[model samples]
Target: MVRELLLAHGNGGEETWTIIKDLFLKYLDDPILSKLEDAAVVPLEGHIAVTTDAFTVSPIFFRGGDIGKLAVCGTVNDLAAMGARPMYMTVSFILEEGMSLEDLETVVRSMGDTARSLGVRVVAGDTKVVPKGTADGVFIVSTGIGRVVYPGLSSHNVRDGDIIIVTGTIGDHGACILAAREGLDFETHLESDCAPLWDMVEALLKEGVEIHAMRDPTRGGLSAVLHEWARASGVSFVVDEQSVPVREEVRGLCEFLGLEPYHLACEGRMVLAVAEESAERVLEILRQHPLGTNAAVIGRAQKGKPQVLLRTAYGTHRFLEPPMGELLPRIC
Candidate 1:
């Protein structure tokens, strides 16, 4: 019963919250969330950016990371994607009754370590236990609060002629999750690319690069994110297939599986739009970070049909559409 009223762990909006009008709490009203503050004004200072995210990847644990680290990093990354310096997070856990305490402790410790590494604190949290069949092994809901430092930043600010750059390889997280879940044999191992991006964003800002837009490609992958920006900014985009970074292993796996790399998920990757002149500086700044070592200029904004056009390696172009449904679902 409780699970039905909670937000599901991924970006699909699978779980929906309840609305008990008769027993409505004063805090759940529009007046509260509309305040637009990071947290309730119990005792905080200044303005902050706040975001909530839940995690429920199938199998719970993956090759490079588990649900614990992914939950914390997912929220923190959202805040960073908004150009905010993350500070605090509130974690809530939904555990199945028969789950082991030892495993729970390990997940908690992983969450603690991930939060600490980002210089953030877990100020508050909640836990609820449900019957075995009522829930997945476990689910985590994280609400992140970050202080906004960069001003006038958003994907809505993107413009035509802006250069689009991506940090590192795409489809790693999705491919890794799928590879492990299916127990597929491959020549190389794929790991989840999950991490915080605050440091890289800060360093890029120092380079005086004009960032028109930025986003972490998670559930819907680069294809969804690009289509989103194209619609929001009212501009067309051209992506060179050969320019976008994809590991040979991931490429081979996707090819064998009849999957599209651009439509695959990427947890630790970001796409940014910057002025043509500022693109080089942004690339240089990104290259300095271990996370951005494989960063490359993959596309450019153009004035056309407000759609995504992919330039194939053989001098052919085609429209890139959003995945019909979950190609690789719950791969956050």
Candidate 2:
């Protein structure tokens, strides 16, 4: 069954790696970051962070990025969230047989180009080929190692009154994927805003800002990441709906699909908790970056039930909960 499933491009739900409780993770605990965060905190006597991720976004190629670019940016962003300076990386590929060599080369070149853009290096890698149709066209697993610029930091540092700032417009990446996949039409030439955010993070850190927590809003989107933080920190978050950034096109699409963009996945957005005094400075630094030009201070952590509340523009309030199921399957 495994072999037969691997030979088909889109098999019946057999490609996911929900086996996260396997033995490999059990051995890497404690100082090695077996905690299973996006990146591991490799305390090199000095401060360093290591993170790894696997990209299985269906379609492989998208409007703004390909698998290769996603691999590099995804790993880099993990380090950024941890207040680290990304230095090196290792990439591995699991390719399905029958995928064109030309397509693979394009992906590889894209990976290299993006790494250079971030001033990081792809120092190592491995490759394996599965029978065509058995795997997605390609699967990439990337590991990144970096030096933590902030020694006294962890997502646990977040607290009440700290400001919540988002890097840029939400739902762009998710909308781009939907448009590309369903061949939807849109007025603006919408594209996935996938890119490395280490530089932006580094700039914010350099300003001597005290950040409580940081996370790249990926798989589960803003609500997912925020709820995770709320549960971990035992605090409530009140987000102003009007303050959250969502493009008009994306809003229209979400309304049509009966989906909430806040629950949609984002590849290029980061949620940050900053000390109230430094929130403006952080926003200034984020705005200086091309990717974070739409950055905004959306809300603040509060002392209440550990839940996310959304204050609608019409004076109505609603709770934004974690996404119940796959909003868009195979969507990164």
Candidate 3:
């Protein structure tokens, strides 16, 4: 019986099979993954959306979710932003020696649970264990394949007069990770917003909303997305700074830390550009979903030089620069 991960488990010998058959299969078993082939065989049709991500969040276990959950959600959200339906995923684990089997199992369970909830199948995977101190406790690399249902979603699709909508309050994940890593204490609670977003995207598609472009505001956060959209679409975004929702706790923490909320990461939130006529319908559909209760239109696209302009409540405007130089390292 395996008590702890060993280097032999990655040597492609009996120990590797034992771990694959006993540990991984026990949790992520499915017809595709059950094949145990060199590569996953998946049938596809229509446009395809493929994405990959690696999760090395410093604290693997955080308030709202763990690295495993982040792994699934990150990949799924990438596809969802492109108007695709997430279908299959392959997850690889890099484990540190002497790591507790219980902790490994806990992470695996969370991965399985998140995948199942999203109707995404684990099609293949790999595992490798390194000597302790050579690596963090664990790191997850996930590759996802999705079928695109709505076509023409692109950063270049944003047009003048388009409205920008954010799915929810920003920076929850970044703040949670920062607070946990720094061991900060506050009366208000902060939790990561790591979650699957396909359901919310699908709702918008079903309503026939005219989605011009979409993205999940992750590492570089809302600032990064807005800057990218402005540059790619060759337009300027005039944002109402006050209309951009920031949770009181998050705002307080950002102020104390001298961090801009727009520059912080959000795992579950999405930034979307849609036709002005479809904006309200899209907002109504988003609010109907539990994940989008806090959705709001924060800005409008305009014909101008490529830049994001933030107008504060005081009628002052400034260029919101693109995030640079690793705001939060190892933040998923």
Best by lDDT: 3
lDDT of 2 by residue, 1-332 (tens): 22222223223133322211221122111322234444443334467788999888877888889888988888999998998888877766787866765676677778877887787866555456678667877889999988888766666677999899999988888888887777784445667878888888887888888888899888778988889888888889999999999998889888987889898777888999889999998898889988889999999998878899999999888989888865787677
Candidate order, lDDT descending: 3, 1, 2
Candidate 2 — which residues are off by over 4 angstroms? 1-45, 185-188
Largest TM-score belongs to which candidate?
Answer: 3
How many residue pairs clash (N, CA or C atoms closer than 3 angstroms) in each of the candidate models, in the order given? 2, 7, 0
Clashing pairs in 3: none
Tens digits of lDDT, candidate 1, 9-29: 222222212221211112222
Off by over 4 Å in 1: 1-43, 185-187
List, residue by residue over 1-332, the lDDT tens digit for candidate 3.
66777888778889889888877998897988989889988888889999999999988888899998999999999999999999999999999987877788888989999999889999999898899899888999999999999989999999999999999999999999999888873445999999999999998998888989999999999999989988898999999999998999899999999999999999999999999999999999999999999999999999999999999999999989899876899998
Cα lDDT of model 1 overall? Answer: 0.78
